[model samples]
Target: MAGGGGGGRSLEETPTWAVAVVCFVLVAISIVIEHIIHLIGKWLKSKNKSALYESLEKIKAELMLLGFISLLLTVGQSPISNICVSEKIGNSWHPCSKQKEEDAIKGEEIPDDSSEQHRRRLLMEAAGGSVRRMLAAGGEDKCAAKGKVPFVSADGIHQLHIFIFVLAVFHVLYCISTLALGRAKMRSWKSWENETKTAEYQFAHDPERFRFTRETSFGRRHLSFWTKNPVLLWIVCFFRQFVRSVPKVDYLTLRHGFIAAHLAPQSHQKFDFRNYIKRSLEEDFKVVVGISPPIWFLAVLFLLFNTHGWYSYLWLPFIPLIVILLVGTKLQVIITKMGLRISERGEVVKGVPVVQLGDHLFWFNRPRLILFLINFVLFQNAFQLAFFAWTWYEFGLKSCYHDHTEDIVIRITMGVLIQILCSYVTLPLYALVTQVIN
Candidate 1:
């Protein structure tokens, strides 16, 4: 089969080995960067800068993953573009034609009447019979006659790869440096837990320290003014409260709470932190094992539907997955609420320690759950791309002769834009809803 047309330009092929080598190099560099960040964290710890160290670690973890994702997007573009513009004809695959004129110029042998009719029948079936009307519409087919490919050319793709690579590198460096500089300037802003007094008390005792004045740095003068202004201060307070109203599950906070509850049983008993942590981890591992089967089953089911030309019915598989996540979230919330109640009463519930019960909750299995969520997101993205490619091949390519290239391009563009919007906007909104529900 032939590839999409740009003066007979074939699909830009990337060697499998080259892609593998690039991925390996990216992983190696990420590992090195992480090690450097770890060393900086240790130095911060020695300087008693616990807040800054934790922030650094968090930044490192997030930026490293984002950098890897950016690199993967750059490296995978060519291969994904090739898949988008190619079609399978019978047992063989060929590049799609950009224009009907190119098909005539290629001087391909004409099939017998019956064979030609069969091919037309196949094309019509593939296109769900939409091609006939598209062909009959003369002036409306001008956009299709242009035969523009769905995405950019090879050179443009290469330039995009370079741009993404540079942007990823710059983003990582800029964020890390900004965090370090900001933390350095706020050296006295220790973690709340480490302070001997409350934030309000500290502010009341030394208002000058917290106040913004003419001597304040240029970057912070506006922030100082906002704090000094009555209206702006109310707005800031409202915004802060609004942000705090959002539910957030912090793993470290949960773990520390569990540990404190467990150790509260004996005031004089020597607490073995390492042993307790090890036991908690073992229990959490068992919970993860117990939950793995259903998650894996749903994933496999989705994969089957996705690969078997059941694109239209793909949403069916996600139903069970969503149900599982919701049920798990509810169970987690119930367990946490119960634990908090027991802690507040200072009594054991049914002789089960809060720590032991917490270990079995979804909160402890968060890392595994996050991993699964990432996999699900990747699968969703793959499904979106596959569905788009299938539609382009079946609908767009079949109607190519009708000069419907503009329609094809528009459909492809819309599909891509929707995929991005769903990934970033829709998915996050869904997650927020789930969080709110929990």
Candidate 2:
């Protein structure tokens, strides 16, 4: 009945091209934010000059990106207002769009002899078509009520936007605080490294001070001996686990043991720690880039569906979250496989073989399992895209006056639910299929 709520501007007054422009601007802003965070990380690495600092920078950047994405998905769209008609029948309120479709199904028809009635019917039909077009284009719609029913309100939508904005702001601040603490920890680690080197030198040059004598009393041998040599005391305090595992405690044994425990791979060696850290950061960045498109598509679809008044499918908003989980799981499997390959090549970290950790069932120890997960991820992505297209075609293009809409929605929802359930039950399903093939 009334116009849309942005400064009394009607939905029809907003050009469809403006929606495309807004989407473009939002995407540009997201890219700029990501680049700025990356530059900040580079600058922090230059200033701190520590691998730990670089790691912290990656974490801060990821946290900020996640917060920004959450805000964009939740509150980036135009506020909802006066977009649809809602009728209050008794105490329950429902969209008049549904009511109109129900009346049409009951064989309501315009009188052919009444010119005024025919004109009004034509106007209503045109208005309905325009509303559908706007929704399909990812824009809002406004409908003129034929009855005394009011336009749908926007107060709740505004409240939700404000709440999500506040949470996003808090998330950003939390990430900043964590970076500050991480910087402090980095400084402490640097000091500890220096002290460890100095202690090792002292222990090497003055081994007699750390050794025990045959005539020494028990109290002096245990307490006074280590207390007198602060280097030994510090080494014991820091490398207590290594000390416990050592078979014998002597100058050469303790010196070699400490060296083996503390020293990382040499920079010139094949598996450089710094390069490994950089590669890990790069892999994380690649994952973020890979996942952004699907999330953006899902957000646009959500806006379109919300404008079309598809409240029965509220679970649509969570699809992006599920997609993210699946992507992460697939990445984990990939990383584990890579780690296994490196381990097979005899790569070592800190004198111990590198081994990736994962659940035995899901870990890809064989080529067949790797291929299965790869195909599974591709199939899931294709299925989701197909499902979205089908829903959009059936509900957006075709009018909802037919009874088939309910049946279609139900069938599609069930299929999606089953597919998601199978994704989680992947290990069991894969084992079952393998046994059948055998």
Candidate 3:
């Protein structure tokens, strides 16, 4: 797909429609692929059944589903951008193009004072400023912007409140599901351990009461099970620690650790095998970088409180903050888990080489950190470049000059400098803070 292009050369420049098309096509392709996989799996079972083959079928199903959703978002980016801009424009009136053009011609004739342009700008900013202040003061839930009605109903006055309610519901569901599963596994393991101990006691203290004989064949399998299931034991230990053993700050790390361990295959020997790799990556990232709904809350707060001279620009700062925090948190979660040997291989038992907390700071363990940081920085810069350029081209430069510019140097230079400072300087500093704080 063609990239979303620079500031307003054409409506096509944004690729809004193209993005929608791509998203639709991706979803269709994914559905077709899913059906094909199911058909192939059925054919395999008819030809020759194997437990391994069945497992492969299941893994493939999961991986393709994940890829489908990921690509769906990639193509849906334009819609996301549209939503941002549309929300900003709200419902306020803009001057007719004819009137604007006449005004521009008259202003050019006078050229001494550009007061008309200044009034238009000041009016827009004033309206925007009031909206921002209201939002900041807990009036966001009841914003009175004259632009588009934010809520579906004309009478609605709680758009922000509705957004929060929906988001809180989803977050609560995810946390409950993960923790509940963890607790269930712990209970199962404890029950099994208790039964084993009871059997052992019967054999020792009441030899005549219970007949027991050890079998060599089963011993080999039990040893294998022991190696694989120690991670289960680790799960119990970690869950206990999480609920009762650790401080709140450390819980995020431990939560991620538990997730990584849980995601690791039960069959340790082939844990890193290709069939499982996709799952491992997805689950790992979800724990690491997934944004909480609260981020929007912060975004709203930024927009509301900082409405002074281009103060709405303050909200722009938080975009990088949110992105970096997500990335840094993900990195820390993955690094912490990998160091603990909580990868596809389940968990490490005694003597199995695993990086400790201190060992993780080494460059050797964190080559990915550098790569991720570089890519993240570049991507942020690119986004700012595209977004600001689009906005400026749409309304600023053309409107100022009636679509003509004898010297665009100042405008272009200022735009580039703003992009540079916002993307490179401000974003990287915020990321550093996230790394240290997280």
TM-scores of the candidates in the order shown: 0.30, 0.28, 0.26
Candidate number that wins on lDDT, 1 or 3: 1
Instruction: Flag the better candidate by TM-score, 1 or 3.
Output: 1
- Highest TM-score model number: 1
Whole-model Cα lDDT per candidate? 0.37, 0.37, 0.35
What is the lDDT, from 0 to 100, of the residue 83 in candidate 2?
Answer: 39
Q: How far out, in Å, is residue 321 in model 1?
A: 6.4
In candidate 2, residue 358 scores what lDDT? 33
Model 3 Cα lDDT, one tens digit per residue, 311-392: 3343443455444434433433333343334233333222222222332443465634543443343333333333334335
Which lDDT value does model 3 have at 392? Answer: 52
Per-residue CA lDDT of model 1 for 3-86, tens digit only, reads 112222223566777778989999998789779877888997898665555556555554455457567756775564333221
Flag regions of model 1 displaced more than 4 Å: 1-314, 320-358, 362-374, 377-438
Q: Considering summed lDDT, which 10 consecutive residues are worst modelled in model 3?
A: 212-221
Local lDDT at 321 for model 2: 37
Candidate 3 C-alpha error for residue 268, in Å: 5.1
